[model samples]
Target: MKKLQILAGLYLLCSSSTWAVEPVVSAANIQEIRLSLDSVWVVLGGILVFFMQAGFALIESGSVRSKNTINVLMKNYMDACLGGLVFWLIGFGLMFGVNQTGWIGTSYFAPNEMDGWHWNLLFFQMMFAATATTIASGAMAERIHFVAYIVSAAVVSGLIYPIFGAWAWGSLFDGEGWLKALGFIDFAGSTVVHSIGGWVALAGIIVLGPRLGRFGRNGQVHYLAGHNLPLVALGGFILWLAWFGFNAASTVKAEVSIGRIALNTHLAACASAVVYMVYTLIRGKAILMRGTINASLGGLVAITAGCATMSPLFAVMSGAFAGILVSILPVLMEKLRLDDVVDAVTVHGFCGAWGTLAAGLFFEGRMFNSEIIAVQILGIMAAFIWGFGVAFIVFKVLDKVLGGLRVSKQHEQRGLDYTEHAELSYPEFQHDVTFETDDMTKRH
Candidate 1:
């Protein structure tokens, strides 16, 4: 009887101790029911952002002279491929690896925490990184040599972006630093992605200088046109469709607001397209085909900073204004000695800055934290200062080493499609069409 009582007491004590303990998990097990749905949505949305590369490729090829079409396509493809490896090596780790303190990340580059619960969300982020770097290519097209471009693209994807990203998204850095204390919110990277790309474009343009005959000796502007307009329009349409994914996916999870975000994106894009087409009709004799397409893109960039915060009405207004700005800014840039071959700065940088500020002005409080606007502004400055500063230094160094970023003026007149590349974009047309017809048939 004594032994039996002792054993029973011991069992009770052990059972009670075991019951008091609860299992702990490291991160939120978003691997579960509701989060699973959210995961699917985010991953799919990211895929759409990836598809924008095709849109970018089409737009670039169509906007440039025919001889440079294949070259542009090649550059786009290589950016994705090279950018992917760069992301895996250290970029993702730097961006997401550290704790919440916020200055920079400390850990996440490996494959273990890299693959589950997402289509590799890290991988999806990598695609965005690539797109940002690639945007500079079009703006600097027909002038930059291929080897110089490869180095620039690799450096951007590998180092320039990730470091700044850590400041915005790194919990460790943001938590401990000025950025977090100031309540900086960049929900989808208005300045981080678009502005960085714009700054790089600016650097390249400054370093490359004007294309041959782009400016007369008297300082007036000259036209060195594109090869195809229809293709550019088609590319623009594809980008319009894809932006839905870019802005929406930044949520990182499906929530009640995803629907609102999608709506805002669509409305802004629609408003931009209409407003630009109208502006073109009023200004130019016929539709300035490419300008309207670029204007639509500007609206999309402007909306990215606050798709979730602003009303659909504000989105429309924001987009319309951005469209006008994009449609008109290129002439101003030319006047100022900046050569943006595809106007990447206006579409990405200028519109991006405007969109971020719009969030401060128009965000609906009940829908979003009012603090987001201030945060967005801070983010824009951060992106611009860092992006422009770093690129300026890089381009200056490259210019010193490589004798400027542009091909020789002789190469420009001969056509990069035939001279630098030594491959004819249209040998048959060159043989059959008179110079006038060739110029008329071209999209530029």
Candidate 2:
């Protein structure tokens, strides 16, 4: 009886071991299992987000005149392909695979040559590099040369983007970088990536000036309406879908994965679409889907930096407010005589800042041992300064050396397809292609 009791006690102890902090199971096997599962999902997310590039190309092309469709398509394709190469060679090292320095990431080329997590980190960051490059394409659409754009993509992804990303993330220092000390926390990069892209778009627009005949002699704005609404809405939806990857992937840990991240992202996006539609209805642009789409994008951008730190309720509120900003900011930009073809700056830039700041106002918990309000502000300011400064210089240099950023007014009227590509976007409409020396649409 005594021997049997002792044996039973031993069995009980062994069973309870399962609940202990340390596991008797092999750690190596567990690590491999975790890596295999996480990597597949992460890459799949990237693939979905990559599809957004296609959506962007189609929407951008369809919205513009038939003459500019092929031009826009080429830019989008080139940015992703070449942008990948650039990020692979240099940008990844600077953004994530570096030595964790604050000023700039130390590695410039071949960051994944080292063993361990280097390769996965590089792959994830490469996607963001492509995204940043494409943002500029939309802003500079209808005129930027393919050759010039290729160079810009290389420089932006390989150098410009990586440096800023390093600064924004705590990778700037082993302990506390300036922004880290300030308590700035961008969960995913509303300010760091999208806002920076927006700032660059602003600079490009300023340097390139308005599209030819976009404004009248009396300083009146002209209407350069997009050719297709369906395509625009499709692009917006694709972007919304990809956003799940963009925000959720920011957690960067198997342990951190939770329902909170996804719920916050979805709620914010929903609130944004509704709010923008309502705001635009009140503003009298209710008939147009462009406002609704852009507003949703704005909401997504606004929630990016705050998503992980905010509750679902606050995220929805923040997104609704951002939708209003997205709906109205473009009109304001038009009033100031800036011709942003796809509303890239308003959607990415304006909303990025708002989203970053919203975290400060609405953040309810601590996720990374940082203060939400201060960190959010610092991140926004950092993005604005770095993005605006570098973009201004790049635009100025390109404009000066390239002999004006836009084509001659005569070429603008002739259609970029014939002048730049020596081809027509749609051969069926070639016979009716009308060339003019002035704006085709009436002034607004």
lDDT of each: 0.77, 0.76
What residue runs in model 1 are displaced by over 4 Å at the alpha carbon?
A: 1-31, 99-101, 110-115, 172-181, 281-286, 366-374, 418-422, 430-444
Off by over 4 Å in 2: 1-25, 97-101, 170-178, 254-258, 366-372, 432-444
Write candidate 2's Cα lDDT for 1-444 as tens digits: 999999999888878957567656698988888987677666766776677787778668767877777778888888888889878877766665445435655643665345555455566677777887788788878776667667777888887788777676635214333565456767787887789888888888888888876889788998788777787888888888888888887665544654688788888888988987776678776446777777778888889988887888899998998888877788799889999998989988888899888877876754334456656766777788888888888777877888766777766776676666666677577545745323333211
The window of 10 residues in a row where model 2 has the poorest summed lDDT is 435-444
Per-residue error (Å), model 2, residue 142:
1.3
Q: Which tens-of-lDDT digit does each residue in 85-137 have in candidate 1? A: 88778777776665455656667665454346534477668878887889898
**How many pairs collide in each candidate, listed in order?**
16, 7
